[model samples]
Target: MSQKLTLEQIQNFEGKYPKQLWHLFMVEMWERFCFYGMRGVLAIFMVDQLGLTDANSNLKYGAIQAFVYAFTFVGGIFADKILGFKQSLIFGGLFMIFGNLLIGINPKEFFYIGITLSIIGTGFFKPNISSMVGMLYKDNDARRDAGFSLFYSGINIGALLGGILCVHLGKTYGWSYAFLAAGVVMILGVAMFLKFKNELGPIGDSPLLNIAPKTRKLRELGVLIGSLLCIPFIYMMIQNTDYTDIFMYTIGPLAVVYFIYQLIKIPDSNAKSKFLAAFILIAFSILFFAIFEQAGGSLALFAKGNIHPSVFGISMDPNVVNNGANSLFVIIFAPILGLIWIWLSKKNKEPNTVIKFGLGFLFLAGGYYIFYTMRFFSDAQGLSSLEVFSLAYLVVTISELCLSPIGLSMVTKLSPKHLGGMMMGLWFLASAYGQYIGGKMGASMSVTKENATLIDKMLAYTGGYKELALYSLIAGLILILVSPLIRKLMREVK
Candidate 1:
């Protein structure tokens, strides 16, 4: 393995960021393309092609998203202790490709199989890559935040393409075509990572501890076999919303217990404080994501059924506008925000992580409030102007800018170096929890094609949005009020 790049070597190199960062950025971009592309149409596909009700489709979508993220915790264990990050990521990407292929071939017959593979694959892929990015920099590097922001922009670049192209193909031709496109992009991503493996060098190499080769190989095999064994369990969860609910309930409390256990094991008060701060931040983040994630389920449905298709005579697909516009805004804003943070840091005026999170909640409230305004202006047909609705997405993108990228960086900084992979997975697990809650929220606002009049659907959805707006605003204020205490817990973490 190439010698690990030192801070000196990294500094001496004349680049703004490592070449390896760009390589990983491209790989993650394509991975997001595959994931988001399929996501853009998944709920609609279930309702339209698989002939499920809106409620069933939303629940299933939530289950799929939940499991995909939940499995990342398992993947983190394998990466940290068994397979190593590189192997886990490659295997994850391959599984994702095959999953999409299976769905493209015949989603009606192979939907469960496809979803199961994608979930396992994402488990292996997602956390490891982000972990690897964290590995690229030293613990206290000021450039770390900016690097993550650039990396986040890459994710959205793929998301922009996926949302636009996948929705267009699915709406214009067929859902199968969209799945096929996702698979194709996933294959490209896998190939790119494999070809450029050397660029990543020893960043994600096996741990230094000596274990017998035979034992290591056996553990690797066990990870693979164990993942396959969980497929049936995942399949059941997808079919039965109750199981998904039960899993969410079990996992959230269990994660808290596990974190507390880790805290007790740590002897250093300073280190312990960082973990406490991280735990607090993680908890607050769940509220933001739970509300924000309605974008893929409830918000998408509202866009499809309630928003006018044309704005000023230009026709657009609702899925494309709803999903793609968020990414487009992120692409436009991420760098600018990154620079703002850097400027603030120079002035020693940067907001603490907790305050950033508070801002996230505030912006989330703003986004939902914008959507809530549709209750006033929507027509008897329940159609609102696309311009007004699209503005909501733009607002939410600002919230994401505050929360998502910073959350990734915080996981790296606050967690023990040895537990970095698992902590990253925990970050995603929080997202899994949010997704399940979001699913429930979306399901509560369901508007089935058969039963609901336009006005009825509008009232149900808009009422939900209004409630969410009020709740998020209150949550933001609470976070801001308590942030000074959380800042003390963070100690020198900033």
Candidate 2:
């Protein structure tokens, strides 16, 4: 028992961090390539290739994003209780690769099939990988936060590459090439993980102590079979908003109940305090994501329909500008912000977790308001300068720097060690709710062919932005007011 507990530490390199960090970093980079690559073009593909209405595209985007987040709960549970992190990662990556391949082969007929596969795959892959990262460090390890920051940068690097390359290929060549690129990169991610699993040691080992080998093998097989059986059901859910509505309504309460049960099971006050703080922060995160997620739904459509596709005399793809701008900014600013956080920590002047969340919401609101104000400058075609689009991403990226990485680190710090994977899933579930709402919000601004005058479309989108700005501002203020209390609930975590 003692040997198993100490395995990861024994393997740990004598450096600022563990050797496995780089391995996981590369794995995440390419996995994100698979994700954001497909994501960058999914909306436009639905609109252009399928001839779906604006409303339908936004709803489908929301539904797919919702499924992806919702499935993390399933993945996290299995990782914690059955397959362990390493197996789950491999399992998820394979599904994503196959799914992308299917989409590439015949998007029109197999679109839902491909999406269902990616949803299940991401569910298994995403949360467990983050849990594995958290497992690499002790609860009080100072390097954990910095490590996650670096990992977050890797995610953006992939996003930057995927956004630039995939969008250009999709637009210039066809959707098939873009999806094929996603599948190809996912294979690289899975290959990297397979080659580097040894560095991870027992960090993601199964939690059930001394379980029978035969029983464990059966459990793994059951999980695999069950996941496959879910595909048809997931495909049905993806095809319509009605099914997703039922899923969201059902899952939201179930998640709350699960968290409450976990909270009740905790035996220590310090752990309880940390869990409470995490719960409060997770609640506020929904608003942050609701606004921030517009980047993919409303903002993507806005760029495609309303912004010029050229900048500085260089022709640019709108999807590239839409997706790549944030990644470009993240790559530029993540290092600087990571250093800034470290510098502030040394001075004992770093902001608390709740304060960071508040700042995220404020920046998100401000970004939307910036776009809302630009409505006045729109031409008769309802088009705006590319600069406006770029600035929106800049402010939102700043907001993301404050919130996303901090939230990842915070979950690892505050969650009870045994429940790390489930906590990560809950964090993503917040994203699920926000994205579902974001889709509905975006869909509200839909412009059909009959009403599709540029000016009319611009007004609808700008109006939605104005509403989101107000909502984010209000949420930010509320979170800021309660920051001191939330910090106190974190006990000794910070």
Q: Which candidate is the best by lDDT?
A: 2
Model 1: ten consecutive residues of lowest lDDT:
7-16
Candidate 1 Cα outliers beyond 4 Å, as residue runs: 1-15, 448-450
lDDT of 1 by residue, 363-472 (tens): 99999999988877788888888888888888888999898999999989998877788888888988888888888889988865676787888888989998998989
Report residue 27 deviation for candidate 1 (angstroms). 0.3
Instruction: Write down the TM-score for model 1.
Output: 0.96
**Per-residue accuracy of model 2 over 110-209 as CA lDDT, tens digit each:** 8889989999999999998888887788777666777788788878889889988888888888888899999999999999898878766678877654
Q: List the residue pairs that clash in candidate 1.
A: none
Task: Go through the candidates in order and give the clash count of each.
Answer: 0, 0
Candidate 1, residue 54: the lDDT equals 77
lDDT of 1 at 191: 96
How far does residue 200 in candidate 1 sit from its true spot (Å)?
2.4
